[model samples]
Target: MLDLYDRRIVASLNSKYIDSKLAIDTLALALKKHSPKPGLLLHSDQGSQFASQEFTAYCKENAIVQSMSRAGCPYDNAAMERFYNTFKNEYICRYYFKTDEELNLGTQDYVFVWYNYTRPHSYNGGIPPSRVRFR
Candidate 1:
């Protein structure tokens, strides 16, 4: 999950399939890391993983208000689209991981170290997301 306020990646996971389980697990990780108050708004694409009954129930149980992009409108979730573009070009394309474990660790490091703490973001006036978030 990405925090729109600061552009921080609150949680993420990699899986072979985009299923409700993956959605729920990633959301659970975000919840554990940051205890947002009730009525938190979660914006996402209208994918089956995000629209499934289990995922909906999980959001409701966590007091999250879910919002989805309009059908076939990627612009509605432009931030996420941009994030994925950057993630792919800046990180994914630079390395080859031979194992899932390596990929997971590499992803964690990228989000926690490089992306959040070091990389400059145009949205935050060329500062890192962590700086903008924690300043």
Candidate 2:
């Protein structure tokens, strides 16, 4: 997964399995590259990935404030939710992954090359994210 901030991919990772501590570590490593910039308001759902003790500890260590929505409220993380929905609908659902590497490479291409450089986002003045970032 790649974390998007100001439409730039700050980090990238390949996850065979998703674990809370791994997620925290990946995020922390990424944030370390941009340290002293206030802090991240890490928002997530009540999933185990965000609720784990290790994850919370990492957040505290990094001065990241954790924010979660009320139970059953998806809108709280609506941007991510919408992105996932569009990703699955437009890419994953239509493709067959013969290998994990293939899937990872395809995802990298989609996020970095296609989504950021080609696809236009309405929220970003109807231009691709890459252009907006340069602006």
Candidate 3:
């Protein structure tokens, strides 16, 4: 999940399936990393995983408010879309992973080391996301 305030990727997971389990697990990671107060707004695409009963219940249990983008409207969740595009073009597409473990480790480095700390984001005034977030 991407935190809008600083354009930071708060949590992420890689899986062969895009089911409720993956969604819940990713959210759980974000929650563990940053314990945001109740009533946090989680904006996501209108995917079945996000709308599944288990995911919905999980959000409610954590006092998170789930908001879905309008049907077929990517603009509603533009930041996430943009992030995915950048990630794909800048990182994922550049390398061919030989194993899931390699991909996961590479992704961790890209997100935590390069993207958050080294890469400059225009929305964050050309500074890295971590700088904007921690400043």
Worst 10 residues of 2 by lDDT: 1-10
* Local accuracy of candidate 1 as per-residue lDDT tens digits, 1-117: 788888889998999889999999999999999999999999999999999999999999999999999999978899888988999999999999999999999998998889889
In candidate 2, how many Å is residue 36 off? 6.4
TM-score of every candidate relative to the true structure: 0.96, 0.81, 0.97
TM-score-based ranking, best first?
A: 3, 1, 2
Give the poorly placed runs of model 3, Cα more than 4 Å off.
Answer: 133-135
Order of quality (lDDT): 3, 1, 2
On the 0 to 100 scale, the lDDT of residue 86 in model 2 is 70
The prediction achieving the highest TM-score against the true structure is: 3
Give the runs in model 1 whose Cα sits over 4 Å from its true position: 133-135
Which structure is stronger by TM-score: 2 or 3? 3
- Between candidates 2 and 3, name the one with more favorable lDDT: 3
lDDT of 2 by residue, 33-117 (tens): 6563557677777988888999898889878888887899877777677777777898889999999999989988977787768
